[model samples]
Target: MDILDKLKNREEIYYPIERNRNTDLRFTLYDAFLAKKRFERFAPLFMEAFEEINGPCYYKSDLYKSKLGADVYLKLDSELKVAHSVKARGGFNEVMVKVEDVLKENGMLDKFDELSLNDIRKIMAAYTIEVSSTGNLGLSIGLCAKAFGFKAKVHMSRDAKDWKKKLLREVGAEVIEYDSDYTYAVKMGRLSAEQNHMSYFVDDEMSEKLFLGYAASIFEVAEQVASSGLIPSDDEPLHVFLPCGVGGAPGGIAFALRSFFKDSVRIYFVEPTEYPCMLYSFVHGEAASVNDIGLGGKTIADGLACSAPSKLVFPIVDSLIDGFFSFNDESILRAKKDIEEIDEKVVEASSAAALLAYEKINRPKNSILWITGSNVDK
Candidate 1:
């Protein structure tokens, strides 16, 4: 889907941390008793499945830093996984949770150590998974689903790149195209799940599984930050700027960072001005689409062309985000163009959004700008 769309499910998931349990991530597969187990089972695999051995965040001295007037570091998630995007973390996690569910439901899996790959594959083959996406999410979802032996389908909108759909199809996933935008594609995907048995929809806007999966990246970032010698304290605060789409990735990571770094961190979300869905929803006190706010046009930054901020991710973003900032397509294009011209690197407009966050706000000194995707068409 072109333009689109938290886990506001349970009460205590957002509560104070007196319980010594992780309030940062609560999902179907996680609880106070099972948190460590969940992390142990998933974190290593999150690294392994996504080729995260060199999961990197680098400090850069560039013209963008001068423009932002901050000590800027880049979290290069654009280069992550086979999918080569930030969605790799969340998409893989969602499918693995389904793997757990299928294994448990059939009374098959006991421990990860005891599981047989052959047996797991046999079980996974019976399940089918579906998700609606603009592009990047489909790559991660399709790749994960294919790897796990599940029949996968991606329902998408016109704003999605043709190459993304082609890549998904090449991997044996059914690509369902729609002339409509992201929200419409998502509704159709939801309808199919309602009608089909043994089918699961990986809802980008609202899946707790996806939210927590992306949240797990904080551990990787913490490790990277430590190695980079970047400290998060009042004297040298860690400022994170993430590109906001449906808000799952940015919100998940932001809240998790807040739990880890607390007051020493400030998280900001950057959105395309034409489709500042999160900004509108955050300020308006409801689910407000781009059409609701009278913004139109397909964008070069198709990833950020979301109509509404995700309901599932909104509360976390509202609570944890230091600010929500918006910029025009021209700004994003210029950022992408300038970076390519200066650094001789080709990055998607979405990747440039994090750096553009600095231009909009009065940012802090030590900053981390996450480059979320590299899937740009030349």
Candidate 2:
């Protein structure tokens, strides 16, 4: 069968349907309505995001779903070039998957797995690096290190969720807690990593792989939009608003959109007023640390409560994004209520923050808001 047929026939093992030998699982009309509503709400956003970025061809993979995240897929081009996955926390898993694919292609899968642990240790030792963060990127790297049989150390801010800290420990990572915020934890992690022998800091903050992998979301969005026939006319530009954490998602989406849309799409970035790293960066003409911002230390939007932007993503944001907006906690709460009322879907505060910004700024009718993830701890 052709690739298209294969994709169409790809059944989700987790949601199995019975055949003649058994029986097909039937869905009520209500179920169908809910499903359609979800698709209508999300598909258009994905499609427009992809088309404006000029992604021509792609395929979807089930990796993200397997991890209990969203049902995400990796996109590929006609030449079978793998572009990016739609996973929110695209960090170590993204890197490992690509590396493993390359190794498998070279007939070195077993050797690659065997060498990965030692290789990681050597690299860490060389760089004197210790990875630290309160976010998924750091957690993913720590998990990867443990999987590869390498020791991992992480520093998390006091405000970090308890579950995250527990998960880090469950993966055999050495976890340190800081009394201060994320930036302070990062500094402590860096200093400790530098002082210890055989320690290498896997600074997710500066890692090109992390930011590049995160950018892949746009490629999928581009392809989906093109396939859905929702590409905006050449005369009018699509406006895209992305929520900001450490500016990774905004930076990645902006970079891809810039490459695809050129001057045809206007990009806006939104961040919590409590941590407006991207907005601060844009206003300052360079990437600025949020450590000094009084409100930068905390937010109900845990995913977007980052106090600094990644150095790698800053340039992309500076050049590609047209505007930046900051939303307060009260506004985010109202936005969340509005989304739940409109779609009956539960979205995290981070995602709602983007919508709130759009409402506050009086965004264009043809605008797109990236509701990035639903990883709320509530």
Candidate 3:
């Protein structure tokens, strides 16, 4: 059968392609450097806003020397303090960027460092932060919004977990449930935000702020990996397997890695078989959805149940990404189980996609499987 037919059958597949790496000039190393500096400037604000975070969200990488039998490490973002997911990196960064803009407009930017949490919250209360998500991003946005006293409205797709919705509500966000899929929720959320003057929408599909936030984290990733003595070279390439959703997080990461490591790293995105939107979009040379190909677009990996890849992200990372790995829910469940058994930690199905990719791919001397989030239910 053809690749499309194979994808339709929900079969496990790895499609590798030569990427031109230098094709996109819209985002550059300078952009990443600027984002890194911006993140550093917001460190104090993040700590003051979310006391639980303590400091900037730190990535925890554990080397599994015996388990994988190779130089493999799990970059566990699931253990992050604030939102307990990789989404917190992007979500919190975007919110802080917006907050910074507001503070500057009000002549409080100079005084921002001296302002108390309540002082900033009083200003933030005049605005609303909005977004649509399958789960994790919504939770991140809601938590960040309420922490800064901004009203939050999360448009949730039907596939979003009940626990995520409950957590969002508990954080004082208005959760609007949609009977349809992620695309529809985004459309509604965008429209609603456009109609309001005091609303800021964290567009998962198109927000450069969110993309930059994810991209900036790669600086920490590179530092952590280098500290562990696994530097990527010509013969010893670093293989990074990232879990994909609408392509924002993974795409940002892949772009930054390509800029940093150049040809020394092989970046792969892992997606649900039923919703391999990024893979399909990459192969077909256009923006398309799983629904366009008659797939159900539903999966146990709710965070990865996106119908279409992000239009903004896909084009930027199209030349940087090396390949795509698509797997069924059975494989995700099995990977999750294996991870919990081996690491004694529970991860969400979406996060387990990277682990499955590492297992399916050829054994590399150095590989990093980025665990995106924890299963809050567990």
- Cα RMSD, each candidate: 7.6, 17.4, 1.8
TM-score of each: 0.83, 0.66, 0.95
Worst 10 residues of 3 by lDDT: 57-66
Q: Give me the displacement of residue 75 in model 3, in angstroms.
A: 0.5
Kindly give the number of clashing pairs for every candidate. Answer: 7, 15, 0
Model 3 whole-model lDDT (C-alpha atoms): 0.83
lDDT of 2 by residue, 43-101 (tens): 33234433422232222222111111122111211111112212223444333443444
Model 3 off-target regions past 4 Å?
58-66
TM-score, candidate number 1: 0.83
lDDT of each: 0.71, 0.54, 0.83
* Alpha-carbon runs more than 4 Å astray in model 2: 1-89, 93-129, 291-293, 361-363, 376-378
> Mind giving the per-residue lDDT tens digits that candidate 1 earns over 112-159?
556555556678999899999989988888988887789998999878
Regarding lDDT, does 1 or 2 come out ahead?
1
- Sort the predicted structures by lDDT, highest score first: 3, 1, 2
